[model samples]
Target: MKDVPVYTKSQLALRNGQDKPQIWIAFKGVIYDVTDSRLWKNGKHYEHWAGQDLTLELKDAPHSSSVFERFKVIGILG
Candidate 1:
């Protein structure tokens, strides 16, 4: 598998929850999965995962690459 691209804070907002389970992020023109991170916290900034009740807080607690590395994608939208 190839390394997922990185996205800045702005590019990610454009594609947030756009009828797709995934979207391409461009931090430095590279694409990656912002969903893979656990920085989204329910009732705070974002909602929780479907199967999970824990809200993600990327601002307060940025998601670690080691934890979300498995969810990385090349150029696909879920």
Candidate 2:
């Protein structure tokens, strides 16, 4: 199988809509495209934002990481 592309935090930041146009977030080092989700509109999710590692934040979320399964895996966070 092919390996996922790894992205740095700085590189991921460009997808925050403010910087570019896409919205991406990392959870447990795996990056997911949240662009199509209404929850991620404008690259912001409540107090969280795109281009971030959400592993630690998930603890406070109502849902688990499985929620990310619906979204596409764009890459990995390095």
Best by lDDT: 2
Evaluated against the true structure, the overall lDDT of model 1 is 0.39
Best by TM-score: 2
Alpha-carbon TM-score of each model against the true structure: 0.31, 0.92
TM-score: model 2 vs. ground truth: 0.92
Give the Å error, residue 30, model 1. 0.4
State the lDDT of candidate 1 residue by residue for 1-78, as single tens digits: 254444444444444445345443432233345564555322122433322212233334456434444544444221
Query: How well is each residue in 1-78 modelled by candidate 2, as lDDT tens digits?
Result: 158887899999888967888999988888899999999999999999888888899999988878999999999888
Which regions in candidate 2 have their CA more than 4 angstroms from the true location?
Answer: none
| Residue 12 miss distance in model 1 (angstroms) | 8.8
Model 2: lDDT of residue 9: 92
Model 1 quality (TM-score): 0.31
- The lDDT for every candidate, in the order shown, is 0.39, 0.89
